[model samples]
Target: MNRTIAIGDIHGGLKALIQLLKRIDLSPNDKLIFLGDYVDGWSDSANTITYLIELAKQNTCVFIRGNHDDLTEAWLRTGDLNEQWLQHGGQSSIDAYRNFTSEEIKEHLAFFKQMVNYYVDKENRLFVHAGFTNIRGVENEYHDTAFYWDRTLWEMALSLDDKIPTDHKFYPKRLLLFREIFIGHTPVTRIGEDKPVNMANVWNTDTGAAFKGKISAIEIKTKEIWQSDPVHELYPDEDGRN
Candidate 1:
């Protein structure tokens, strides 16, 4: 049977990404769902994008767009860098592309343009870079930023009781609308761990691989997980997210 895997924000941790895939023993038959932020934070963003571009040729890959990805795409297309993008690890990705030609930049921009904001599989599993406010109408959300920047949904999930609230339930239980929701923009490292964290029916796969943690991937059906070494160890000389 083909494996269904969901990976978290890569943040240019190519080494961590390689190790995570190796740990999971990912194959061509695997349905690879990559939560975004593929570039930014660490060095080697170009290599990371190149590797994923190649990996897509060999596997069933779904790429979701994260906020960082949007910024990078915008800059590549128009050479416009906003203060926010530059402050939040955008320089790292820019430096990573110091050797690229105009054609290569355009190619990379095209790849980013192809990325979707959110993807729902046949099983009703929602895979997104960040949070979505309306589960039912996720595709037509008014605010695109919510897909790559929202954290309220996770906060809701985290604040709720583990068991289905039989008494007074939260006004809007977003997790109840799907089989499961998988997200990546918010790093689990903030909660004091460098691994995937499950809260209610939502799974946070980002482990801060761009900073002090590692990259992660989880099998959707089996709940099996794979992680890389600390991202710092992978790029000791570089100050990630600096």
Candidate 2:
């Protein structure tokens, strides 16, 4: 089978991303799918985005929009925004783009907007920035807020016994799609430890690269996992202060 590598939240760890790619030994036939959160957190969001854009130009790179990316796009457009972004590692992104001119910012925004909400294959595997909610008849509604920022869904999915509740009056069915959903939000302390209650689905990544945790990537078909050591630390004083 063709190799498909799914990388978790990068959070501006450009060096780690590059290192992880080198460790993986990617081939021309392999595909790399980034699980979003490309910017923010670490000190190299701008460089990270530039590298990803260049990589996409050369390889079969699939980008998914994360909550941070959404806020960055919003900040780029309005220049007026809330503090949540800064608190959650958006400062690095701000710092990264500080040197860029207006034209460069516009170009970056164009690339960011081009990211897809999710990447699905013919097999039972699905890659999304965040877990999806079974809203109404839709399997994954792909709500921008939920897709990028929501943790409640992650908690609910993690806590469920066997079936995901669709009691929002939006979804009548108790269970959504039967395929396994691979997500990146709600960072786990250990990789591959969290397992879905109902099915073979798994939230096998997001080891918290922004909070002094490892960065993870996994092979879709082989279930091979790789991680990088924590590169930076987040102080408690930095919390909620941006």
Candidate 3:
């Protein structure tokens, strides 16, 4: 049978990314959904995109745009970036891209530009880089910000006690539109854990792969998880999103 795998933020951890794919043992028919933030930490931000471009040739891949990716794309277009962008490992991305040719830069920029904000599979499994403000859909609702930046949705879930009153549902009705929701912007590691944290009906897969934690990937149907070694271990010389 085919598996629908949702991956967490990469943050330019190419070693982790490669190890993750190996661990998944992707099948020909399986689909890989990347939760984004593929650049701006560790190293190989440029090479990581190049690898994904090649991988897409043999397997179905869904790339969602994350805030970091948006910043990178903006930098590529204007040839300038602000401190906010550069501070959060964005300088690494600039360094990575600096070695590319004009055509390579355009190709990578186009790749980032074409990334979708959110994706709803046939099973109604919503895959997004970050949380959404409202559940109506991301096409127009918070089109520019919510899809790749909102955290309140996940915050609401985390705020509630796991065991609610017998008659009360764990979450609001708005988030129930999808059978399941997967996101990657919020690192579970920062929440006092280094693994994917599931709350209510949403799963936060970002295990801080760009920082000291590992990159994570989960098979949506079975919830089977696979992880790469700690990113810091892979690139000891670099300062990851720390």
Candidate 4:
């Protein structure tokens, strides 16, 4: 059977990504939906983007734009550094691209431009780098930034009572928009989970690979998970985003 897998934030941990993919034993028939933040954090940011671009050529892949991706694209296009972004993880990305040719930068910029803000499958599962604020649905979102920056949706899900019926008037209108929502952006490690966390109908896949955590992926239908060794272990010489 063809499987659909949702991957967590990578944050330029290409080694971890490679290991995770190997463990998954990828099939061309399977679909890989990446939750983004493809660049930043680790030392191989530029290399990670190159790897992903090539990976897409051999497999079914959906790339969602993450906040870091947006920031990196902006800097690559304008050469204007975002101080906050650099402090968080952007510096690594910039350094990684220092020796790249203008043509290569343009190619990578084009890839970033092609990323979608969010994707919904036939199964009514929502895949987004972060969360959408629209209570109505992603189509109705007024601010595009919310697609890659919003945390309220996940917060609401975490705050909910699992016993609350979907039909309950107090149940969030947003959660009703899809059968299930898979998100990245906010690391599950913040909640002490080194794996995906499901609350209400939202599943957070970010396992904090940017910091001292492993990269993760989940087969949506089977809920089977795969993870890499801790990203810190993969690149022990450097402090990731910590």
Candidate 5:
């Protein structure tokens, strides 16, 4: 069987990603699809992106653009952005660029722009950084905010009840299509776990790598999920749960 592995949000957890990859025993024949947010929240954003780019060049890797990636790319392009990025783990991303020269930054930004918004297979399996509002519109037709930052879309896509339509506008009854969408943005308790709503056909791969969770990846064909534990010390907990 062809093995295509879709990785969850890395959040700059290069060590954890590497560990999970080893555990999966990835091979040249296997395809790896990264759902985005490759940088931020950890200490190795630069290294993570660099390695992922290299992987894209040499191996079967599909890199999708995440919300955080869009923000970082904006900073890299315009050299100025809102302070909201800092509150949402942008400080670590900024630190990642400290060592790179202006030329290198430009190169990275260009690479970021080239990333595809989504990936789809003939089997109706869609891979997007975040869920889409309407699946009927032309691909990549939605705004960047909807592509990366829209939480409502995610909620709607993951809603189990069929009462929530995939598209706001109705199309031909024969054209009604429900493709299984694989996404990463909202971190769930674990990877590969189906959402509460079963009708959405959404798979959340973010295992809270930046928080108190692990990094995760899942095989598209087999639905085999793999994860790596946190490599660093955890923040002190006032509740004494640690």
Candidate 6:
């Protein structure tokens, strides 16, 4: 059967990405939705972007922009580095592109530029890199950057009592807006989970491939999960954003 899969943050772990895909045994009909942060952590940022570009040609895919993607794109365009970005994972991305030609860099920039902030499908399922703040929903959001930067939505979901009925007046209006929300900015690993965590209707797929966790993917319909070995294990020679 055709499947719709939501994948977690990559953080340039090309090997993990490859492993996850192989385990999924992808079919032409399967739709792959990648929560971003495609770069900034591992050493294959440029190559990972190139692979995604090519992968799109062979299968259905949706790419959502992440905060890291935003930061990396800014550096690519201005050549100005953000100190915090470098310390976090930006240096790995920069070094990854050191061997690329100007034309190649341009291609990668175009790839980043084309990523969407969020995607809502026919099923009313929301796919985004991070949470949105607007109670009214993404279209009425006051800031576009919030799509890839906000963490309050997930935090709110986590703090919810879980006893509140959906129809209760105090229930979060934003949570009621979509059938489900899939995000990837806040790593589930931070909360002591190495797999996807579902709080209320929001599913956080960022299993922390950028740090010590493995990359993960969840089948939207089946809730079945597939994961790669810990990203740190895959790249034993390098410390990934640790």
Record all residue pairs in model 5 with backbone atoms less than 3 Å apart, i.e. clashing.
none
Please, what are the lDDT tens digits per residue for candidate 5 over residues 1-242?
55898888888778788888899887878889888898778777777887777777756888889988988888877878668887877888888889988877777887798888888878878787876665564263557566676566556545445664656465222124435667788876543443212235667777677676677888876777788875344323211111
Which regions of candidate 1 deviate over 4 angstroms?
A: 163-171
Clashes of 6: 0
Q: lDDT per residue, candidate 2, 41-118, as tens digits?
A: 877788888898888876798898888888888888888766977777777788889998888788888889899877
The TM-scores, one per candidate, come to 0.95, 0.82, 0.95, 0.99, 0.82, 0.99
Q: Candidate 6's residue-wise lDDT over 1-242, tens digit each?
A: 99999999999999999999999999989999999899999998889999999999999999999999999999999999999999999999999999999999999889998999999999999999998988889999999999999999999999999999999999999999999999999988888999999999999999999999999999998999999999999899999899
In candidate 6, position 95 carries an lDDT of: 97
lDDT, candidate 1, 1-242, per-residue tens: 89999999889999889988889987888999999999998888988888988899999999999999999888887888789888888999899999998888777877898999999999999998989887566866779999999998888877876665633455454677777899998888787978899987789998987788888899999999888998889898998984
Residues 152-196, candidate 4: write the lDDT tens digits: 999999989889999988889999999999999999899999999
- Stronger candidate by lDDT (4 vs 5): 4
Model 2 segments beyond 4 Å from truth? 135-142, 162-176, 190-200, 233-242
**C-alpha RMSD by candidate, in order:** 1.5, 4.7, 1.8, 0.7, 4.7, 0.7
Q: Kindly report which residue stretches of model 4 are placed more than 4 angstroms away from their true locations once superposed.
A: none
Q: Score candidate 1 by TM-score against the native.
A: 0.95
Residue-pair clashes per candidate: 0, 2, 0, 0, 0, 0
lDDT of 3 at 58: 89
lDDT of each: 0.87, 0.71, 0.88, 0.94, 0.71, 0.94
lDDT of 5 at 163: 65
